[model samples]
Target: MKASDEFQAPGLDLFSFPPLWPGAPYWLTKPTLMAVVGAVLICVLMWAAFAKPKLVPRGLQNIAELGYVFIREHAARPFLGKDADSWMGLLLSIFFLTWIWNLMGVLPFVQLPVSSFLAFPAVIAFSVYVIKIYVGVREQGARDYVGNLIPRGLPKVAYVLLVPLELLQNFVTSLFTHMLRLAANMFAGHLILAFFSAVGFWFLFERPTLLGVPVGVLGVVMAIVMTGFEMFIQFLQAYLFVLLTAMFIGASLNPKH
Candidate 1:
């Protein structure tokens, strides 16, 4: 479809969306590919940096070390406590993995951000949720962990009413919501960007000069503005995912009542 014939952006039209190929596999979509590539790249980069442990770290090792220290001392330790060392490896892996995937969205050629897909972000969130639940149960025992929803000072009758509600509402729902929130935000943001970008392009190049060019220019302006917004959102979403995961870990560690 020509870009400027209609006022609406063609990119956002579900019926006329671009296909990567005639019939790509579910796992081979642009977003999925970007995520996979980003993950592999991060792994190789880390291995290259730290393979030869050095007394005087330089190059990538030095940069990687600084990152590790930040997450270990600041992110994991505060929430997971002294035992954070045990889980620090996992947290660092996830943090860098997430950061790289989000970073890929803006990079040329690998413009697709995997986390923008609901499936990808959902998988990550679910993984963190499972680990959080496992930690809580393992440390506190299932019974105690389950009992933690209700406060300690509640009366006996209140416990009967509140415990189930707390468990049903906060603990259970938060996990799902955490994943959905990230997925939804990324998904919507990416789509909006696509729409506006397409509209801007169509207006600039396809339609008649007087009408199409001016509208397209406006569209391009909006796209630039949104692109800036997307960059900010990308970082914020990554931060929220990791931060919430850590907070959940903290909650699980201390099963109250």
Candidate 2:
């Protein structure tokens, strides 16, 4: 088979198809397209939801209200306490943006989720980390915040080993894990979907013998199952990301627990 013929596979070929730009702006990439589309969609949805400004909320207002309530009550309240009212909008933004980006990866023509990239998640994580540290220092003062790491009643000898571990785990390691958790989940899930989808086509078109048909059917079944699974993971990873952010912020603001 020619190189072109060999390159032809199911999900693999989907990405192999020419990008919107061959040698131009980076924004023209597939993942960027998804991110842009997700952002636009959210903006439109927000506008529709709030444009009328109904008291009872008939259409989009209802959805907007529900989202507001969910983040406020379920996510922010439990983590950030009564003070979370100030951070509600920020938390909501991250929650929905993460969700939309995850869902965007599954869409046709824009199969990549930018959140799957470390740069995107890192940006978010770093921002949140900065906010957390800022609030921590501001609320407790740098002395108190740093002091909180040492257990209130720990022996002087134990401080030698425990202090570094506590600081590393709570302050440093957390940021890395929080960011990578979202990015890795999306990246791995999308890649698996692509692989399975490509293999399915390879089975059907490249090898059409009696054995190939059943295998192709199996591949298709796997692809469908994986896609459904990815959708769930996408939402879950987004929620987890937001939830962790809330938790971290909560810890920084109130680390007594």
Per-model RMSD to reference: 3.3, 2.9
lDDT of 2 by residue, 139-227 (tens): 99998998886786768899899989988987899899999999888878887887778778887887666877888788889999999
What lDDT does the true structure give each of the candidates? 0.74, 0.82
For all candidates, the clash counts are 0, 1
- Range of the 10 consecutive residues with the lowest summed lDDT in candidate 2: 9-18
Question: How many clashes does the backbone of model 2 have?
Answer: 1
The TM-score values for the models, in the order shown, are: 0.83, 0.88
Best by lDDT: 2
Please list the residue runs of candidate 1 whose C-alpha ends up more than 4 Å from where it truly belongs after superposition: 1-4, 10-26, 53-57, 155-161
